[model samples]
Target: NDWHTAIIPNWLKTIYAEDPFFQKTATVYTIHNLAYQGIFGWRILEIAGIDEYGFLYPEIAELANVVDLMARGILFADVITTVSERYAQEILTPEYGEKLDPILRDRKDRLFGILNGIDTEELNPATDPYLAANFDVSSLDRRVENKLDLQRKANMPPNPDVPLLGMISRLTDQKGFDLVGQVIDPLLRLFDVQFVLLGTGDPHYHAMFRRVAEEYPDKTGIFLTFNAELAQKIYGGSDMFLMPSRFEPCGLGQMIAMRYGSVPVVRETGGLADTVKDFDPRTGEGNGFTFKQYDPWAFFGAIIRAVETWKHRDVWRKLQIRGMTQDFSWDRSARKYIEVYFKALEFRAAETVGGSRP
Candidate 1:
């Protein structure tokens, strides 16, 4: 139905509109992105025949916008969460607040931010079928085999000497697809790097990358559709992952890349900032290279830094090995959510005289 997109806001309104069900059951709403909040009109709600005193008002109906719905959801939801703790706080600010600052502040105590986890078993470099040679956590030799295989598979010349910079994401303005397009020609010419990208998003980006690929056939490969297996191969075979998100709530690709033993070269924003620590060669402490500035040059400069490190085979190998070993699993994250759930339950029970855990 056309109203399915409006279901969330409608349901939230319905739950609290002199109804006993919301009072009966505890709900914790997870706001993954405030920007794309599902906004539908009161007309749809009226068509659905769900008019109530609180929900029938004109202002209430117009609150169907994404940001307002988030605020409304925060008001009614027993608890809420975002992907990371930093983002949880970021959403409460005026700059990063997304116009829900006051609402988020009102519900601050009940809100939680747990870093999302990736399915590591599926992403393990050792057992991935997409790679040419599937090895385990212990053997890094098979990694090289997969790398060479990916080169042959993508039809790019097997130049192990060149840094294979791979990216898999929705080619969008916020994703720094604009930045990539801005500096792509210069970056390709300047660095000994081969670009392999697999994604589909903005049509202009798809066309742009395709044109770039046609112009620099030997240097770039663009796959416009998202293939799960191809993404795995890209992660397994590529030397580094590229993500220069302008404002990321939390990203799964960088985590997936780390699991595949691919170092991330990303802009320091949102989850990328939290996950990919800046590389300090002397200490060898960070997982990948990161830059804070959002400009294309800053992103490309980080790539050059990665390339420099890649030239030193031993150092680069250590970075890849450490990334593969880093745990980005769902287990820890699930536990945190479980804690949040129980906390919500406790609060819910406290609000009801007869309510108690079964």
Candidate 2:
């Protein structure tokens, strides 16, 4: 799906170029994250046996002396796709392109963005074994028991009225920890909410959150280790799920959060933009709270909106039910993927009939 298997397209286009069976095969290259392209020195191309092709895009200066496997995949694949519709568009711009915008733009017509889906059976709140109490949209009242269980596990007093915000991600700038660091102190000071964080990453954030936990022991629950059971508890317990990422390709967290009845509060970019619509009080239409700009205040503003919305119990329950009831299953996404596969096959058929590679 990413750089690790990107070279398969290169091998198909070059090493197996003349083979009748391989010629009929169409490759669909999917980019999960563009930032981690498998780039190496030019000499390594000989080892891959594609040295005869030299560089895929020598016109692009940065790629002149390197073998970028991901670029090769993009150049050779019949169809290119990313995780979400928004990310497919974002990667065409310089801001989010990760130096591959030119090639991506050239192949824009072949590019497709399909929003990812979660495993409904495994993540279903009604069936999750990890949660203290299993509850669906209909039995949402029973969900509070899980909050109390999570509070006890995190060593905090169980308060049903206080909103509990949950975050499960690596502690890094990409995940929007920088914005969190900036607004967390004020958020804790200004609001009567409890924040629970799970997952570990950058040492700086680890140290930062450790201090946050130390300073606000009563209001913060920090676990710097990965625990699958604890993760399910956080999803089932928290009232709001936070995912203010700098750029998310396609976030499964927000979908999983919604499935578990945790309303998402996320930055409007990539999959987060496509999935989590901003909550509107008047119409009550959205599944979550979202901010567009990457500024700390913008993120804080979205959080405040969620916090305010939580005050209205009936409206909040409706929002939760709206999110929980919506489908984010593989059935829809699998159909889209089948379409992409057919489109890829069409491209290959056209090339074969025309006697020219597209």
Candidate 3:
């Protein structure tokens, strides 16, 4: 779905260009993340046996002497898509394009965006064996047992009144760890909240979070290793799920957390923006808490709002129920993909009849 399989489009357009069966074959390239483009030295083109075609876009100076497989996939594929609609639009700009904006803009007409969906059957909280207690929207009161269980496992005090925030992500600046590092100390000191973090990443973040754990032993839980069971526990147990990504292609974590009855607190960017609507207290609508700017104070402000909202027990329960009931299944995303596939075939048909690339 990303850089690894990106070269297939190049090979199909080059090696199989004249093959009768391949001539009618249309390729659809899906970009899960744009940051990790499969870039290599120009000599790699000879190894790929597409040296005759050389660099596809020599006019773009940055790609003129390099073999960028992702670019080739975008350029040669009949259709291109990203994991989320917002990311597809974001990648067309220089900020999130990873130096591929020119090429992506060139193929913008053929590009589409379809959000990735979680398997609802597998992620169902009601059927999850990993959770300490199983509950759905109808029986959300039963969800508190999971929070107590998670607290005991993390060696923290089991207080149902304290708001527990859970995070399962790669500890990196891109995931908004920089923002977390900036505001976590004040957040812990000023608020009556608890934080539980899972997943492993950069050594810098590991040391930083370790300091947090040591400083706020009573309120913080840090698990530096990945455990699928623990991940589910965090999802089902935590009062709020944190995903402050600077840019997310299509984050499944927020969706899964909501499915598990954990209200999401996310940064408004990419898929996070598409899926998480800012909660309006006046209207009593929307799914989660969101902040737009990629600033520490902005993130801290959102967390404060979530904590304040938690004070009103009835309001909090309604928020959790609202998040839990939303449909994030693959059915909707599957239909969009089917539309993109048909669009790819139409492009292929047009190319064949017109004897020109679409």
Candidate 4:
């Protein structure tokens, strides 16, 4: 049901509000993605036999026709949170808020952003069961074995000299797939690099990538769907990962790629802006490359920078190892969630004279 789809575990609001037993337990709602928040009109309320004849004047309730459920969740919950510190800020902006700006403004003091973490043991390239070879941050030379295996499986020409650019994401406007699909031919013509795209998305984007693979069989490979094992292989094998989202709340793929020695070349937006630091040649402090502009050329420019740095084999190897060594674990995120739960409990305690929990 669209209602339920819009409201995952949102029913707790009414339940916890009414039942003191449930209220004793605090709830910390994590907003992984906000764009798909549950939204509907007066009809839904009316269908449920809830009267809409009153309290419809506020600008937000006026759109009772389409109130983002997440927006309402923010106002209703004792505390709210998102995936990254930068994304936590981005959500307050009108452009990114998607009509939830006013509500977010009201609850600004209560919202906390926690950066997500990955399971190192499950994702390590050396221990991963999916990869063709086992290698660590130090023995990265062995990564090429997995790369060759990937190239052979995909029918791409085996060329260790050429950089392999990888992308594994749902093909969508949000992912900036529109730009990649439109400009892939030009990019292939311009560089000797190989692009390997894996994921299913809009039919047009899928067709476009298939066309690209057909046009340049040796340089372009498209897998139109994702498999967990295959994703691990690409992460451990590919030389570079590409993420050009229009707005990403927080991305897990780029982090995983770095853990597997794949340097990321991403657009600076949302969590991408927060996680991937633009590479610096002199200091060599940053992990990967980034571009601020959304234009196709800006994306190309970032790729060019990555290519220029790749020429320095030792430096590039160091960059990969540095990225693979980063930590983004769920435990850190879980602790932050626990903190929000405590805040919620405090709010619930304050509202109830009996001091019931939230």
Query: Which candidate number would show the highest lDDT if scored against the true structure?
Result: 2
CA deviation > 4 Å runs, candidate 3: 53-56, 59-64
Give the Cα lDDT of each candidate: 0.77, 0.92, 0.89, 0.78
Q: Give the per-residue lDDT of model 2 (tens digit) for 20-49.
A: 888789999999999999888887678877
Residue 276, candidate 1: Cα error in Å is 1.5
Model 4 Cα RMSD, Å? Answer: 3.1
Candidate 4 versus the native: TM-score?
0.90
Show the colliding residue pairs in model 1. 126-135
TM-score pick, better of 1 and 3: 3
lDDT of 1: 0.77
State the number of backbone clashes in model 1: 1
Give lDDT tens digits, candidate 1, residues 1-358.
1122334534644545346766545667787776765455446445546554344323223343222344556665567788888778888888777666767776799888888898887777777777787866578766777677777777889877778989999989989998899889998877678999999999999889989989888888788998988898898889899999888888999998888778899988778877889899889888899998889889888888998999898888788778878778999899999998898777766755554321
Show where candidate 2 strays beyond 4 Å: 53-64
Give per-model TM-scores: 0.88, 0.97, 0.97, 0.90
lDDT of 4 by residue, 1-358 (tens): 1123323223444433576556555445677777776676656655644454344535344453544556545655666778888888988888887777777777788778888888888888888999999999778889999899888877898878899999999999999987786667777898888888889989988788878888999997789987887788889879999998898888988899999899999988777877799998988888999988788888878888998899899999989878877767788778877777788778666756564322
